[model samples]
Target: MSGLPDILLAAVTGFGCALFFSSIPVGPINLTIINEGSQRGFKWAWFIGFGASIMEAIYCALSFTGFSSFFGNPGVKAVMEVLTFVFLLFLGAKFLFVQSVNLPATPLRAAAEKIEARLEQKLHPRSAFLIGFVRVMGNLGVFLFWIVLTGNFMSHDWVADALWPKAACVGGVALGTNAWFFALCFAVSRGHGRFSEATLLRLQRLSGVCLLVVGLFDGTHIVWQLARHRMALTS
Candidate 1:
């Protein structure tokens, strides 16, 4: 393949890969979006996703530029896994322990909520964008994910070793990531109103527990791998 056809094919592959992977089971990024959407509404949540999409594109481009080896290095990969474990564990605990504001209605509660609304209003899109950026940066999984994906595409000769095709694919990744985030934010915002305050609180706690479970699983896997590696070395 050459010219526009090659570019188009690579772009489509990148788009499909980004969308499919991003839409997979609950992870830090999506969980944060869901939590924030419930609390602040669609705009805040969407901004976060937008920031993440930008980072996704950057990471995709990095993959084409051969940064994948850095991420794949055993030492670097181990540190990233450890950091990801800690990050997930921290978020899980934060969400689990943190109290939801919209409790059962009381006269004073209205005033309290008004103050909170004012505060949330002060949270500009820039702040939300930064939060999204920082959140993804902390996760490390996003970089590793792109590493594996880009490698697969290259190995299969799906994307050529050329500038334009790679750039087009990176652009497609941004679009695909944003598309999923938009749909998720829209759905969550639309359904948010239907939920009672108490229900929302429950949902928050449930998401927290799920995050904790995922973190624990990741930590366990890391430990298992380390143990096996040590045994092999000693043997």
Candidate 2:
């Protein structure tokens, strides 16, 4: 069908969005998911990634359908942004505080030992699914990103005429976006044995800091947007 290309393009867009968002500061959740899945199998990694993609699809749908507008209210957005920033700052501090000397013994080289000990026990399938679900839900960065993308699409002049096609494109983007995170986790986890534990810990810390920075930036942006909206309304 001629519509297929549109759908594929949409999927690629979604993938790119997800990749860009996830590539930023890594976090325990993503890293853990990757490491766990790597320990288990690539299929599990794929499943987790797929599950995350589905969540993104739901959010995208909500944004496109105008349901996201309820939360998009200037006041609400401002509050959420502040909360996200504070959360990130707190996480960053925690990462900075965690001493690396407390890890258990492992055959992995010192570089890898740190990470192996930091890794939580293997995650069950149900747990992984739930984690994937929660991660998507709590990930304000990704949520806002999709919301913006969907909003832009909806505002277009052709939105009404090409509703179905546009929707398909958004869905595709969601799938593509999520695939990257899942793939990363699977790949790293599979090869974790080859890396030093210390290297793993360092990676985790780096990811934590990255998330914190993103959270701060998002929070500030939301606040500024709210202020501008207030000024305009009063004027």
Candidate 3:
């Protein structure tokens, strides 16, 4: 493929990966930041997204370097699957048990408001950059997903040889994934606001249920897979 076409294709693939994955329950950190930014301001959101993109880039680079293979061993995969399952289950249980809405007057809400107020006070470029950095660091699942996607892309023969192309592909995907944050910020900042706090809360609740279902399904699948592997070994 020509460079332009190749870059475009890479960008599409990157965008697709981000869009699909972001729809998943665990993938909503970017969305959360975006929404928060909409409520707070774009500058804050921009830094958060930028920081997340940087971490994603680092993970993609590492994945490209074959670092994820360390976790590809059957034993390691099994362990990871188990841990992931447990974590998801825990998250689901917590969602089911906890109160779904936060009152603005609640201490937790107050604390959050204070934090945002502080962030607003420090809303310089440097502070925005720091916020972005910190937000990305806090989002571990997104990092892991980026690593996996990078590993998969690196394994492909068509585009593997060209470092620039590969980097572009990764960058394209990161941008696509983080695009939601920017959009949300822009929308909220525009003041043509479509989503209310109630709407956001409802969506969050629905997302939590979806996460719960996915966790149960994945956990069951892992158990079945482990059983089959054991049976094959014995047979």
Candidate 4:
């Protein structure tokens, strides 16, 4: 392929991969955006996506620059897993018990109520951004995912290792990620009026349950690995 075509292919590959992955609704980031959009509105929820996309781009760049080995280290991976487990546990419990989304009869009053609740650092635009960023940071799975994806892309020669192609791919990833979040937030916020507070609260609780399940799964895996290692040593 020629130079421009190579760049385009890399960009398209990145975009498609990002879009496909981001569309998966299992992650904490997705749930947070949904909760925020349904509770607050689009503007505040969208900033979460902004911060997430930026971190995603950084991860992509690191992957492209061959920093995958850093995250691949056993010690680093163990630390990340522990951190992720703890964070998931805490966030899951919080979401499970969070009372009232501040939904009032009037949108204005609802907004006012939300702002007042946010004074306790519950939810706001800036905090939403930080929440997104922090959530992704604790999510070691995302970093490992990028590592594997970029490695596979390079191995197949689907994306050239040249700086330009890699940069284009990273940019495409950021855009693709942000696009999904925007669509999700838009849909939830637009239809926010259709759902009762009870239903919204149920969804939030469901998200918490799912997160806790994932964290438990991870913990189980870690324990199993340790047990196997111990057996090997004993043998």
TM-score of each: 0.58, 0.49, 0.55, 0.58
Candidate 4 stretches with Cα past 4 Å from truth are 67-126, 193-235
Q: After superposition, how far is residue 223 of candidate 2 from its true place, in Å?
A: 24
Query: Per-residue lDDT for 52-79 in model 4, tens only?
Result: 8888888888887975445445675666
Model with the higher lDDT, candidate 1 or 2: 1
The lDDT, on a scale of 0 to 1, for candidate 1 is 0.72
Give the runs in model 1 whose Cα sits over 4 Å from its true position: 67-126, 193-235
Q: How high is the CA lDDT of each candidate model? A: 0.72, 0.56, 0.58, 0.73
Candidates ranked, most accurate by lDDT first: 4, 1, 3, 2
TM-score: the better of candidates 1 and 3: 1
Predicted structure 1, TM vs. truth? 0.58
Residues 1-235 of candidate 1: C-alpha lDDT, one tens digit per residue: 3699989988998888687656642455677787888889999999999888898888889877985445545576676667767866776686666576333454554554464355445643247887776556544556766775676566445677788888888988999999999988997798883545465566566656866887798789789988999999999
